[model samples]
Target: MKSIKTKHRIIKAVSALTALVLASGMLAGCGGSSDKDSEGRTIISVGSWPPEESDALTAMNERKARFEEANPDVVIEPDEWAFDRQTFYAKAAGGQLPTVYLSGFTEMPEIINSGYSSDITEALKNNGLEGMFNENIMDIISRDGKIYAFPTMSYVLGLAYNVDAFEAAGLMKEDGTPMQPANWDEMVDFAVKIKEATGKPGIVLPTADRSGGWIFSAIAWSFGVEFMEKGEDGKWQAKFDSPEAAQALQFIKDLKWKYDLLPASTIINAEDWYRSFAVGDGAMTVVAGDYPRRVAKYGMTPDQSGIMAIPAGPAKHVTLLGGEVMCIKNDATPDQIDASVRWLKTRYNNELTDEYKTNTETTTENAKKDGQLVGIQSLSPWSDKAESLVWYRDYIEQNANCNLNHVKLYNDFVADCPAEIKPEEPVC
Candidate 1:
């Protein structure tokens, strides 16, 4: 195993931030009225609160306490109301949404057009966060030159593999690094090698719950396939049926039939894919950037995980970029909006403020204690010059518990041969 204390080289900062923990930056608790409780402080309800028995709840509460102590006149009422497409509109229509809540980046346009969220342009400017965001991220949460949400984090897709499986298959380099696939073609050969040596499915592709289409899109993009484009009249056009898409789909078919590299089962969803990869039944899977918490839950040790760039195709290399944003409810009062901004800043500010330090320290300590893996690749919504980025890197390095070689491999790619980042297109 690689030393956890190995010095991590300074890599080019990617577009995402390391997901400190799933429940850390986005804090929510039991849903409640967005009004003053027993006290006179203005209540700002927010979502993504951990369950009562979760270790994360204690961390959330600690953050809540610190936030309350800092902003005495504002109170934060946590909620567990995660965004669900099916239930969101009903909640919005019933005026039951939290003052500030986590939402998908793609949902912003709909939420804004439907008047379900507040325009926080002025609030962002007021809080010294106006210039922190990457412009591409700004576009996602903005409409008509006004900002409505704050992008907390972003991620790109990559090939996450079982380190031990690759070694068992004699796929490791002399320097103890995994022999990562460089292109889709090489991925096939590598899959065959792993299967022949380890007697396990070499790679898994998700096929159920629409993830089959989702994964295929990335592979298609690598093969130089554009799924959609605007016509001369400005109407959107579908282009996914091109010959390149057929080639990509054919590759998947060959994996199952010609190569016999995929699992025997015909059905595999995102959940099953992660489970397979975690247990080494499937040696590799496409994973969104960051340490995979779900894989860890399925019993994979930190030392067993490794991530590399998504294999390129004939035309180019690309990865899908996506993240979560914080949206304020449309009807929130000025005080509520201002309070929400203050609260959000604590989660994603560029300055090395006391609040930021406390939040990071608390989250890191709690994650360490919870038997979680620390330090993985991520993209940040903030600019490259965000001062706190340096602090965060040092902190993670000092406290990292995972095998640093894996982190080095992923970060080295981000710093060296980073894939072209493409934002996800909206579904019509």
Candidate 2:
């Protein structure tokens, strides 16, 4: 019989909002030229612009046109440069970045300390967006009481499992729900069953590009391991050299050697891990709540996959929080910052206006029409009380395309444990 547990668990509080950070290369001028365009509009370069062949480009251009129509003095120049750890530094150092661009939420420290991101507190205030964001998310991008970036989306990690694999392994219940692991030990047994039935790797983890370490931390956390802690001398000390951490590491080792649940290649990157899981090379992988959209393009159907809270460890049931943010360039002129703030508000469809409402409706409708996954649950960047969130929530419910049964466990855990959600280690 497939063993099922009633208790749902989630990660410690690591609050973040997930948005595409739009950063310009260091070489690109916030306004490529100080002089106005022939039409006398102030030009602002932005990143996360879809490629010419992308399906999202049309929607992006439409939003840009509307923003320009509403604010005639500003012109939005889209840059195709994307955010990556390696190229980000190259762009920042070379001065080719845009006026405002995309970046991960965790990169705030490096971006701000390196002087790549501008202080947008006053700009946010001016735009009436000062107190609109979730405070916990805002905290991640703020330093010394100053806000540096805008939180756009939020996410928490969950274990994504292949429904087909579960059924094939006889791990599915009569009600059509897969029998999920309640703890890490059960996860191993479940993987063994999956491997025996499917003749495929039962679980996958990224082992390259520091993704291995990233995935390791969550596992270690669940084992009651603290990567760091303040000592009596008031200095933060590395604490991972503990029994709990060793157990976590040993668990991973056994997954490969003893249980033989890992893939043929151990050197997987994050992208590879996701794609592998999507294509059914592995029965399960850890992913964020919004990761369904990412795997969708890989031909993973909604009914074929489901997400549940990460299996609990001996010490606790916890996961990692991650997301993205948008920031202004440090060198952007004040006028440029103001323009960027207005543009950001418009781009995110967060402003409280009839025009914004129409834009939101249109965007959601378009996603639905395109058969894009419409309703994977995500944390709101705005506060719970924000009117924008209310409508946005309603719209998601009304247009959701994915199977809610697939995501109910993770979503339910999130709804039930607001206080338990915690931030990840800053250095990771």
Candidate 3:
């Protein structure tokens, strides 16, 4: 809880201005027909995320093209994927958000809580997609007892380890090959080896005054503890003071301090988690499932990196579920909602997966070839990838997402709370 010190409530509203959400930018929603369809259906406006051309934009362009050719009268307006938490909040607060916007599974609470999204519980029920979604995504979007957004894709967390490092540290197979540690103790031992030999930080989180608390939150959750819980009154209440919670927090702190594995500086921005792991400055890093896939672009091969479930905590092995999702504005016409659904159906189709799946699957394959991962969707495609990527196949059953169960009450908690915990800044 040591990240953003400012409150969403305190944010000075950005007057209406367009913005992009992710690295890839937005994809157009429909083909040439972004207005009325051949049969005169109203043009529907949609937003794309990661804003640039990757598999997503390409797949979108292809699908939107087909959707337009099939229905000449229906125009599709695929706006840039610019809206994110702050922008979404601003639009919701000002009521300027689009009829349809896309985002992640973890974003549901913030979306609905801000009052811009509407419950499509009935629509989902009618469309037979009600059962197709995972409970985690549905739970996050539900507010005042209603479901808001629909899931688009799913993803989860895993431990990305260096295969060579594991062998070099004597933590791998007899052949000094790839494998994951069975528990936390062995995990920490390997980190120490990397530190002793490499003279680099063991595992990176964040320790800067303005960052580093996300690692704490994820670790705490992985131990089956929710740092905050909703009271009978339904408002979010901080719960990081429990014995188990304290133990989990202290264990990580000790790793940074006493054990000399996690450097105190590892406690800064969540972004460091990427740099340290991707650059091979750390032997092991617990991160999103997409970590190895994304790092492949940077030349971190499979033989050098691999992924596996985080070691089981004393309580349980856990991961924070995350991924993109779709939501239509409450005020949108029925036509808008239908159009949003049309786009979602197209994006999630197996045919589309054949196109987009490679972003991850291809990366996974490459990582595996170099010893970087087990397999993106192979671990438990039924549970982990089912409904989407959070579970992939069948990696885990019970998840720690959804608004009611245990969601981050504040976006900057990772940076701010730790600042509160010790008050003293790191020496570095």
Highest-lDDT candidate: 1
For residues 93-143, what per-residue lDDT tens digits would candidate 1 score against the true structure? Answer: 656787888898767766787788898988888988878886657778888
Candidate 2 on 279-309: residue-level lDDT in tens?
8889988777766667777887767788878
Model 1 spans > 4 angstroms off: 1-41, 51-54, 228-239, 353-355, 358-362, 365-372, 415-417
Better of 1 and 3 by TM-score: 1
**In candidate 1, how many Å is residue 415 off?**
4.5
**Model 2 segments beyond 4 Å from truth?**
1-41, 51-55, 84-96, 168-174, 178-180, 195-200, 226-242, 352-374, 418-425
Model 2 has an lDDT value of: 0.77
Q: How close to the true structure is residue 148 of candidate 3, measured as C-alpha lDDT?
A: 80
- Give the Cα-based TM-score of candidate 3 against the true structure: 0.68
Per-residue accuracy of model 3 over 1-428 as CA lDDT, tens digit each: 11232324423332212123223453343122233555677777677643686876876777788877765655677678565654565455544555678765545665566556766777655554555555444555576667788666555555666655666665666543344556677777778877766776556555554334544555676565656666799667776677788888788778777787764355445456566666766777766555655565567654466555556577665555556667888766666666666565555642224545544455444445653434343211112223444423222112111111111211122212211121111111
Q: What is residue 88's positional error in candidate 3, in angstroms? A: 2.2
TM-score of each: 0.81, 0.78, 0.68
Clashes in predicted model 2: 31
